[model samples]
Target: MSELKIVDTGNELRLLGMDEASKLLGIQKSTLYDMTMRRAIPVVKIGRLNRFKLSDLEAFINQNRQEAQS
Candidate 1:
């Protein structure tokens, strides 16, 4: 599996879990789970664990925002 990196506030990077990703994205766990179920969100599954990179989530949000504006 590839590495998951998170860009910190200080411009540093680290790995993050589902809970952290949800909190950072300002969404509920169930909502994140729903997105995953619909394959609407990008995720990394390692073994039985699911993870997400901050950059990926940000990109997803940006893409959605642009779509909404259009």
Candidate 2:
């Protein structure tokens, strides 16, 4: 068996571009852009472009996750 390790960058977090963000979220770029326009997705404004933090995207996924409890 092999050991698994996660690399942490301390206070530095990686940011993703629109293309990468859309792919990670499994949505079309247009859809993501539309969501951003409506403030449905979390994003950061860099000049005139949109930027997404990987951590924020992860949180968004968790926030929208649905599970049934018995």
RMSD of each: 7.2, 5.6
Tens-place lDDT digits, model 2, residues 1-70: 2222323366447778999899988999999999999998889999999998877787777777776777
lDDT of each: 0.75, 0.81
Instruction: Return the TM-score for each candidate structure.
Output: 0.70, 0.76
What candidate 2 gets wrong by more than 4 Å, as runs, is 1-11, 68-70
For 3-57, candidate 1 gives per-residue lDDT tens digits of: 3344468533444688988898789999998898799998888788878866778
* Number of clashing pairs per prediction, in order: 0, 0
* Model 1: lDDT of residue 25: 79
lDDT of 1 at 28: 94
TM value for model 2: 0.76
lDDT assessment of candidate 2: 0.81
| Reference-based TM-score, model 1 | 0.70
